[model samples]
Target: MRATAEPAIAVTRQLGRFIATSSWLDIPVDVRREARRTLVHWIACAIGGSTHDTVERAVRAQLAMSNHGNARLFGRRERLVPASAALVNGIASHVLDFDDTQLGATNVHPTGPVASALFALAEIRPLSGAALAHALVLGIEVECRLANAVFRHANRGWHVTGAVGSLGAAAACAKALALEEQQIAFALGTAATQVVGLREMFGSMCKSLHTGRAADNGLTAAMLAAEGYTSADAAVEGPQGYAQVLNGATDLAGVVGALGQRYEISRLSYKPYACGVVMHPTIEACLRAREARPDLSARATAITLRVHPDVLSATGKQSPRTGLETKFSVYHAAAVALVHGIAGEDAFSDAMAVDPHVSAVRGRVRAQPDEAVRKDEVHATFSLPGETIEEHIDHVVGSVTRPMTDADLERKFESLAGEVLGASRCGRLLERCRGFEEISDAREVLAAATA
Candidate 1:
């Protein structure tokens, strides 16, 4: 008789145990702080992007399918079923491309998927802020580890956020359900089979939809597992599993080795600019150049940015026609930053993308990919009539090495959420997020965010 294939090592089960057993108290003080920051940033992005045409259409679509339910959308008056809410909120959170990034091919917008699912599930049943925080931390820990494992080796064009997000979202939802190891493992497996996202979708509304789908599907997987649904426990590591098929490799060892001991959520960073995280350093260089020469944009004949090789691959759009496309254009980000001294939501608008002054500078801007350049660092030179001005960044703002302060995050929340919710109500929501762990019902935060 032919020998049968042995089961893959217990990668899914181990992660399940870690997530299942983890509690709010088990999270270190610093990790908890980071979790709150993640919430603040994610809520800000969701509320801010909530007004975007992409989010509006998505909400309209969801509303048409089912007009009324319990779960709340960030900045809208409408309510949706939990899964639909997760999908819509996830899309709104990421529609601005301002959501947090894990910095790599794993552009895993850590909390957008996990927290979106968690918050949506919170509405289905009462969950404490503490539980929300704990689940968020553990879920992201699972997500970054899984995304990191396959993203590097995965086929180019696979967006890691869409590929591994459902896995993390499932973990968080499973944790919220307080499922034991077997059920949690099943949830992970079911989610792993649902991976979706394409790098080709980067410059379109579909990019935000990827995150929405991840949140929706991940929540469905966990709820199914909670109801005794079954799936291959070795889905992440089996011979023809997610890893092998998606990337041909799985870091089973790394996935489980540091769980609980080291928290991945702490590594998450917020964004200062509303664009791809890789373009931040380049924008920083441009801003610095402009600051040094107040008339930099007016005088600089040509601008060149030297960034990590991945920058070009990720944000290489030299000429873009819309706001969403500009988020993936290093050239545009640099040009706009220099010309307007702004990188806020207004800077990447369709009108801004086609602005005469911005377009003129954008065309002259060039990005040279360098293997030696780090993702958080960039080099730039500005051509002047008689001399050249240069700027080099050791580390960009909002990077882990230079994290945004709590106050900075609050201001960001105020800025984004204020416009949508109005100043008074937005301030209340900001306060709720800042004191998230102290709240009794996590859904209160959602209730507070709606206009």
Candidate 2:
């Protein structure tokens, strides 16, 4: 007989121990470099999205709930309690749906929950840059591992970012606070029990709420555990535990096998377009097709896309009526990419969604699911008056295989944040993020990020 697998509880304990014991020196150099990149990308997103209508509404809602604390909001000059700060900043970072994504074990947005919770805590306390980076990596590890163990959680209708993100936030907060192993375990338990997010809420204000709540819930969990709050030690793998209750089964071995040997941050992918990652290939194909044949849009009678089934399942909205819904519509992505030649934040607005020309083009676009097509690859065929132009994208630009370089990331940051912080301040903030480890207080970085 084959040997039995380890219990889910073992995974939780191993993760807690690793977070409690690991230091900056324990992290690999490449992982550390990626951690900084992740932080900078997240901060830029948070700042750039701060002035968004969604963020404005969230901030207003949070302010109504509590108006007493001193944690800074990125890109905006507002103060809330650590938990509220985490909540609002998390929402802001993800409102545009442009945050960095990790596509290795799970497709969770790794930076939002972890960075939001950590920065909130840093503002309340005085955490050094090294400590903050270490915690950020540890936090991502815990959440991404949990995501790997429950790999199909998203397919099951849970937004994995919010579902697994709370645990990541808890881990990062616990590490930043220097929690003991037991405390860290308790923090995980608290976070695991309170996982929040559902795919039904996607493409709405509620979707951003999931990320905000994950950050808030995890920060709260860590704070509670730090005060000696007790929780189930086997919260992750126990009977009726997080994995069993939420996912029916868990890959405990996958969660614990390479605890510190490999870091999940290394598998991160930054989005070049402000839409679902699955739609990127289609957008790239459309853009490339447009570039090769500039008159393709005017000449094309129909556009057909062959893509992975998951692409349509995730982003198949035919007539997206709102900006938020447009982010999930692959048809809109393709249409805009072909018509406007760009799918940046400016391309996914309510106004852009309702544009007659864009609608005309998107109406002609059809996506057919093909299991043979890889998720990162797409085949787009544009039928003109007589001729057909075909574009095949085997590797999407933002995938790990074709990653955005540091300079590419900086350009993306400048484009997004320059509007909010102006060109000079955005430049300064980028420098600060690149040298985050040398900072004495992590809050200084947060301060510089704001307008």
Candidate 3:
């Protein structure tokens, strides 16, 4: 028998070379626009969540340990070290679970770690808006591709964002610093070893912390690499490395092929609701059902929600006890959307979790998994008095099929960032982000966001 040889592809170093050698010109205009859009969305979420209790406690903890640096978190006057700032801002961006989501590999939040780490570094470095946008796109691409290469969310407990975000963060930080290919490889290696976050932490504050730690660890990895810290260049695919150790996958064809041609950032989707993406469709369907039947609350009956199989695995919580927990509860989402016709931050509050009306509706939600349903699609049925009401959403709002407009995003940003940054400041920040690619210095964003 002839022995077939294994294909050779240097996954980690190749990625590093792409990151190190790629120029801003290599990124297309639309991709850069989407990247800038992502930054705007991320900043809005960060500012909106800056006052969240999670951010409050995390900032206190980091400051208590000595907050000494020039790094700035969104909508906050407090200054922490670069690494601490990344952690605090990352947590703030995701505390409300309203951060932008990219379902590339395993439903990961694409920009939090990369943007958090990059913004932290920008404060200490002379990063231009174009450079920041380029690095941000590359960072997001690396994590999404790496995740696509080794994702096993169906049977595994790894929170893909925490598990794979470090690589993206390290890549972005390294690019922003202009590290050599070898050093970028080392940064990735360091990040590959520090993959953290578990699906079990989904509903808890630890879930947001996973993103913060990934950003902090990734920034540290790049800094260490710049200072000559080294690791196996093939850390991502080597023996007992991230892929094999975590999901037991070895082939990294997805990570290396189409390196800089097809961008994953353009595919990035925004969130209209403040909860998990898994519940968006259900919420949309429920809200539509209410609109279809104005007397929905009076005619409330046996409700059934058929969603993607992943939805059940991810957001199957029936009796969530807290607002954060409610974000992961499909029942609560459907309940609130139908009852209140709104699913904003207040809809998922700690108080809403225990609301009698919301709970009553939540208790009656019958959720089942359907393989045919996609993450952005939902099927709902309501048993009314005279007739059975059914609504099916092929592509929920904010999905790729029906993406939010730039004006829609602006309004969204204004509503969320306005409360914290105020009308004048929020408008300026929004304009700055809209023209981010032309700015000479990225740190100006930090100054503009400072409360």
Candidate 4:
């Protein structure tokens, strides 16, 4: 009777090696299909967010920094360095605060890292739709697995997208390059050194900067590894390594377990509101209540929101005065939803935040955390003229249970794309995204989106 041995660190390293080089033929059909969907969604987000001042500024600034390279800028005609382009485009995709969100991993935005890396590589390698699709799947798996491994650790203070996403981004870049298993491992180890971000800066520009830095670091890691740059093989598991020094709990075994079989990216939730995901349900509840009784919110004495503890961490402003601040204010979001009966991108503008009526109501609104409401759901109650009406939203529109309809997604695209390309180009871009998987040339999709 011999005792069985536990899986070694070598096994985890092997899994990382396998993931970086796995091709379309290696993954299942369903994973491949889901990958295409994720890519289309990522493109949609980038196109929609291109109109943001921050995104536009960042892209323009990066363009000035480097004049060489062939990587395509989202919603623009010029090309920049692969790494720089990814950083700018990744930030643009998330700059407006409208992007895909994973339910299980509250703070991880998959497209920011994966799409950023893939598009950067695609410009250089001219990857096929199938190859590009597979890369996205592999990238997503890496991001989500790292997300799972570090989410609890992230909850303590680490920004997983910054810390773990750098590694994911490198993994994606290695896949796109079709690197050898050993090279891929080297890339991962190189990426490990660059992982860094703090959740304390969630409400400001630095929040999105995390995504940008991760995108840049990840691509740089792969490119450096490809050129024979070296990193410690024990980058993840060694004492003072990624798991120990950075996150304090990286769960290497969990990250590598079921590497090819389980897919975590397909479970992500799309966002309807261009604000923090935590505030979405509260915004929706206010909208519903307003529609049900319009006058109630108009004359409300006070409003109260019951939400999970993370809301305050993600988007809770006790007293906010600016438009950018409103994006992270549940009170302001609720006020906008009630006053305008919607929480679109316009609702988060500085003008709207300072509106007499919105400000008046926002002053009276209060938010408190409740153990009963999960981080993804919320319970909001409005105290109006005659009564206190309550609504508990388990799933907001664009969330898993109440997913956004095609029409809803189109509406979001129209609002953002219209700001830059005008109505004609916007309409064409939306059409291409709906049928993106069938396209043979990735340029067709990019051209249609930026036209």
Candidate 5:
């Protein structure tokens, strides 16, 4: 008899089973702590971005079509259905591009999709903090692992956050509902079929829409599955399925190997600057160079940056006209970081982008890409009248090597949410997030976050 190949294991079914069977106690204490950090960071980002013009327009558009529900819109006074709330909150969390990022070959904002969907579901149904945390860990793990499995997903111009994010949202929602393994598999299948987002949408409001849509779509998928919706068991690995169609190749082991031995959530990195992750090293180097020679700005003849080649592809915009465009401009980030000594959300505004000082500085700054440079490393030099001051950063401030402290996260939260929620409320909200596992109802945290 001819040798026969064993049947392929269904990636979607395997992942769904893992998510379905996993419990809060199975999660590591460190993973659980990171989950709380992810939630706190996401909540702050959502609230901070809630008042943006993009969010205002989005809310208005959603209100026109949505029926009222019990879910609270973070940082706002209005309420919407869980689906709509997820959409809005997801957009808000990412509008500023300041949310946490997973550092690897494939970069995705794991929290935006998972946290957005999970919180929306919590509002509709009661869930303990432990339940919420477990779902979050599983959701991020699935999205990031899938991202790792797909070779060059970003190189093909597919925003992994929006494309793979749908699957993450589905897993989180399925876990939150305590669905059976089969139902969870169906949910992943349904969500996989609806993957949305394109890299072409970068530097526009539509980019944020990708995150929002992923959250809404995933939640909807899980809801349908709970009601006995049926979909392909091999939705992710089947012929012409997500991995094959989207990435052109798949690494099944990356998705399935060491399933519970390591947690991807622990590898998450928060952003100190409110822009693309690739620009962090450049910004950090520029900021340090400026500090070394405060007078360099006035006497400087030129500013030059040597960075990883990937930086230009992602944030190469030299002359950005708007704040949104500035987020994708490495030149603007370096300029503002040096001129203002900070790169917070305020530093990436339309006014800052067009400010005469920032524009002049950015115009003089030049970037050269070197293949040898790492993503988290940058070499920046400031040319002055007499001499040049050079600064090199081996590891960016927010990388896993130099992770943000709890105090740092708290400060960042206050900077983003204090204006909307007031300092006292922000403090309380921070405490509530830190003690997340003890909370009886996740809704209380959401209530505290709202204005």
Candidate 6:
């Protein structure tokens, strides 16, 4: 009689088979629909981020340092090395701070890993849009499952996205390569050893740097696996393995539980703004207050924001001098949104961040955690310029609760893509991604994006 496989072995077998066999058609109709949405969301973020000076500098720096030959940079035809391409593209996807966020698994960002890996592969392979979308599902599954295993670890000191995301990147790359079960298992196993990041780097560019490293390392792992690099198949759950060693816990079953049934990618939150996810609600509040109290500038004495502890911890930028700093600073974003009635790409610019009037308002804005408010909720009360005008924001306007309409997503796409690709190319890119599953070759779609 055949013996039952160990849980780790069973999980590896299941994940390998799932990655090997799962396709767009196998995914539920609703999931396929959401996957398309996620594609649009990630592409918008990448396009929006491509214009950031920081991303440009990083891309150029990588090109100068690395010897890898030319690979396509997102939003442009300029080619850098594969690793550089992954770094630049990954940073672009997350730079605008407008990528999709997974609420469960402690609100980890999902697109960075999948998009970063897939784009690098697209530069070399013949992957289809359907295959890319399916890879996203598998990548998100890997990230969320690993994150779920290490949820407590993130609290202890790890950045779940960076740490678990490395493994996610590897899994997605492996799937995109169509690796065999043993190869996929080994890739995950090898990637477990490479996982690393800390929450201490949250405020700096280094925070996003973690995602870049995950994409790079993940691609490396896939290439190594493809080249016959061998790793222990049970790296995730072996004695003193990834779960116990890195996370201080183990849950092989949880990693594979409801594997085919429950879908995490379908539930991700696509951002409508380019600031921190925690700052979105505050952005909405400031916009609302600006609309309501046009003359309250003199009346507004102070603005108080009651937010979740996590938000305060994650996005509480006390004083921002640059757009990047402002992205991490709730105080800056809230102040700008209320004063200007909008927080667009330019809102976080150095000119705006250093504006004396903006600084004055930012000084008055205070973010504190209140247990009564939901973790995702941002309640804002404003003291007006003429009279004290107060509003309680029950939720962010463009959140999953009050999602951005398809029209809103289109507008966001146009705003981001048009900056680099022009309106016509942007429209073509959006149409191609929306109908991604039907494309025979993804390069044609990618060509449209940059054409």
Predicted candidate 1 versus true structure: per-residue lDDT over 204-275, tens digit per residue: 999988899999989999999999999997889887788878877756677787678888887777899999
Candidate 2 residue pairs that clash: none
Candidate 3 global TM-score: 0.97
lDDT of 5 by residue, 55-152 (tens): 99998998898756778989998888899999999999999999988864676888899889999999877899989989989999999988888844
Q: Which ten residues in a row have the lowest lDDT in candidate 5?
A: 1-10
Candidate 4, residues 333-446: lDDT per residue as tens digits?
988888877687789887887888888888888899886787678888888776789998887777767766556666766776777678987778767766655667666665
Give per-residue CA lDDT, model 3, range 1-451, as digits (tens): 7363333567888999999889988888889889888888999999999999989999999999985777888999999999999999999999999887774246888799999999999988889999999999999999888777788444378888899889999999999999999999999999998988999998899999999999999999999999999998678877667777888887788888887889988887899999999899889888888988867855777899888888878888899999899999999999998888999999999999999998998888899898788889888999888788889998888877788889878888999999998999999999899899889999988999989
- Give the Cα error of residue 5 in candidate 4, in Å: 16
Full-model lDDT for every candidate: 0.88, 0.88, 0.89, 0.75, 0.88, 0.76
lDDT of 6 by residue, 1-451 (tens): 6353443445555666677776667789888888888888778878777867767778778867874665676686667777777877887787766777875237688779767877788778778888888888888888888787667334677877788887888888898898887788778777778876787776566767777778887888887888888887667776567777776665567787777787888767777677777788788778877887675444567889888777777777698767778887889888888777768778877798798877888888888798677645777877655555666777666666776777788788888888889988888888888788898787776677652
Model 2: per-residue Cα lDDT over 1-451, one tens digit each:
7365446347678878888888788898999999988888898889888998988988888889888978999999889888999999999999999998875335789789999999999987789998999999989988887888786444578888999999999999999999999999999999999999988887898888888899999999999999999888788987668987887765577777777899888988999999888999999999899888887777799999999888887798999999999999999999999889988998999999999999999989999999899878999899987688889999899889999999999998898888899999988888888999999999888888876
In candidate 1, which residue ranges exceed 4 Å CA deviation? 1-8, 153-155
Candidate 3, position 137, lDDT: 97
Error of 1 at 449 (Å): 0.9
TM-score of each: 0.97, 0.97, 0.97, 0.91, 0.96, 0.91
TM-score of model 2 vs. true structure: 0.97
Regions of model 6 farther than 4 Å from truth: 1-14, 66-70, 152-154, 384-389
Q: After superposition, how far is residue 206 of candidate 5 from its true place, in Å?
A: 1.1
